[model samples]
Target: MVSGTGPETVPEAEFRSYYGHPVIKRPIWHVPHMPLYLYLGGLSGASSLTAVLAGLTGRHRLARAARITAALGASTGSAFLIAELGRPARFLNMLRVFKPTSPMSVGSWILAAQGGLSAAAAVSDVTGILPAVGDAAALATVVTGPLTATYTAVLVADTAVPAWHAGYRELPFLFAGSALASAGAAGMLATPRAEAGPARAVALLGAAVETAAATLLEQRLGLVGEPYRQGRAGLLLRVARALTAGGGLLTLLAGRSRVATAASGLALTAGALCTRFGVLEAGRASAADPKYTVVPQRERVETAGPASVPGR
Candidate 1:
């Protein structure tokens, strides 16, 4: 409505005045649901890592837990996502069509595949059904697991939220690493160190990824990524970095026994949770500020120069 060929048409002195709040629409969902999604995603990823390790080491029990966890995590996460959508039945529209540009579409399919595979793998013990199916499911888990761990970053980034979208590359890698670490940690506690060696390796890898990804995220964002680097997000990120570092160290010393592995696992899990929640909060904060959005747009306009007005 305020479009003009020249800046003077709106009166250069009459700067745009923002209303009381920044957003045009309020987020309908509650906090628990979003964070629940974060939890489910982490759980699913962790379970996948567990499954892979278990299969590799012939630790069926750990593998069982991994399969069950992945299934449950995917189930719970899907429910939360549907609930967050405001209408459960409308969720089907997500699958009615596909769009690679739409992170939700990609994520939904990823989740569906992960859930199906996880359940199939778990049902091997429950129904005494098919061992072949179980093995197939286990194989599927190895592929879908990383997507489960990482696609969430894309989902969050697809939003209009500047903070998340800007950190896209780093966030996905970070989440994937964290997921592997958390699951491996859980396995270490549940199984012997000899069997849980993969878990330790996962934890160490996750810690390294988390640290590097976080650093890259901050460095790459510059001013646009300021929301994540300051205030509550900043605090959470610092904690995550510390946890990852400490956990990686613990993982390296995992041969010391189950206790060390357990500690590393816990640290990695904490780091994963922190990263997810922190990113969410940072997005909200970025959206809440007019300056963050306005300044950038203004600079762009100034750089582009005044536009030509048809009637002027």
Candidate 2:
């Protein structure tokens, strides 16, 4: 009879912090470099995958172009990543130890492997140097390609960024779809229209997947998703959505004319770039707002009890 309240009826304890500062560290990645690296990595990965698929299906020219695209993208993306580190000499330190628990380490290894394979494949195509070896190298990318397309999602989600972590499940799919669209756009741009049929199909499918994942991410993320629809991030995502949708629609008629194909390809490529920038902006916005960090933590405590509360 001494009880003041039942367990289920207990009032939620108010959560407070030191002047509403973010409880977690914000990402230290610089603008343009990190986001651009993500976009390029995705494009490289998907291009490698597409190259392998095209080669298997007897589209030699398209496959050659895709291999070169993958090589160029991966090489350029690695340069961006190295620049982000701020010290080219320190790049080797990233490979000192393999830690399965470290997404960065995993990604570094994947990038290294991808760069080598893609370069080898591209060179082989250009010089007819070790043709079978080049083909095998291209095929090897089939394994690393999907990982490259998706691991960046895990990298971002593993961080404390509220928007990124909250959308972890959808982020991988989003990035994968974007990667496909990017690679497809490159393929369509570089190859003859007659040989671009698979590229068109891939682009459309990718656009659909990307659009669906983005919509779901925005809808299901609740307050955490707000950053995606406000200010610069919002503008970028909105534009990306429109471009992706429009580009996908245009893909149906792209095979009919070079102008249509080029237009659709350009739209999809721009849209993919916008998506990466928008996602990065959203993460930055979430980190900038203390509420995004505090509120979600408070909710977890309320639902699971204080013992389960994460240490700030």
Candidate 3:
């Protein structure tokens, strides 16, 4: 019999990267600008949708408020984006070509289109010069608005960032819901409580969707999702959830009191902004950490076995 040492246990491998550097480069997008653009883009998109719905339902006051909000959000968001790019021409340059495969290209086009449409709608509403043209512009936004709101999710997810790529499925839903909540809040704040019933309903629905999507994203991502639960990202997200949930509940009671409507609107707006910031922070954290990148690649290699790995 061979003198035998029973099979020895293998030591678990510790994650490391070349010189402790991150495997992937961190995002170049700046703070406040990127997150704020995200919030405003979503707000513009959802507000446009809300405006159309309100107009169709004959809620002129609510529709007018939403239209103005959408225009302002788009214009302001574009300015932030331009600032991030460091030149006004860079913003215009993006519109020079449209690439179907590129999220950035598509998003740029959508932003431009949405901005123009919303602005026209707002101007027409305010000036009362061309009702037909304004109505057409507002109707046009229904197509571009949702695209504007959700395209940023696609943009980030297309990157190699583990947390963002992993949560791709949920990100759109989260963004969409946040957008709706933002627009609803804006509508409620700008319009009287009596005319804000639809806005309240939209806010509640949006809050529910946002909360559910965020929960599912954290639960489904396993290790990749850790960034969202740890550090600054985690803190912001937690606050976002609390404020959004609280604001949603308050929206239920807003019908009876103007104070309640204002409170709910403000809370939901703040919550939506927090969510955008939290998501951006999570992406940065995940990209900065080598473990998030290495572990997932290692897991895939192990699952495929040494024989199946490339160059084996």
lDDT of each prediction vs. the true structure?
A: 0.75, 0.91, 0.94
Give candidate 1 misplaced runs (Cα > 4 Å).
Answer: 1-17, 23-29, 125-128, 301-312
Best by TM-score: 3
In candidate 2, where is summed lDDT lowest over 10 consecutive residues? Answer: 1-10
Model 1, 1-312: lDDT tens digits are 344654444445532336676642323446768867866876786687678677877777777767777788888888888888877776778887788888888877888888888888888856678988888887878888888888887777766677776777787887777676666666666666666666666667777777788888889877778987899878887887888788888878667676777777788778777877777777777777665667677888999999999999
- What is candidate 1's local distance difference test score? 0.75
Candidate 1: which pairs clash? none
TM-scores for the candidates:
0.84, 0.91, 0.94
State each model's C-alpha RMSD to the native. Answer: 6.0, 5.6, 3.1
lDDT at position 214, candidate 3:
98
lDDT of candidate 2 over 1-312, digit per residue (tens): 246664455577654456865666777888899989999999999999889888878899999999999999999999999999998766778888888999999998998899999999999999999999999999999998888888999999998899999999999999999999999999999999888777777788889999999999999999999999998999999999999988888888664788988999999999999999999999998888888888888788899875644785
- Give me the runs in candidate 2 sitting further than 4 Å from their true place: 1-21, 305-312
Candidate 1 Cα deviation (angstroms), residue 40: 1.9
**Candidate of highest lDDT:** 3
For model 1 the local lDDT of residue 150 reads 82
Extract clashing residue pairs from model 2.
none
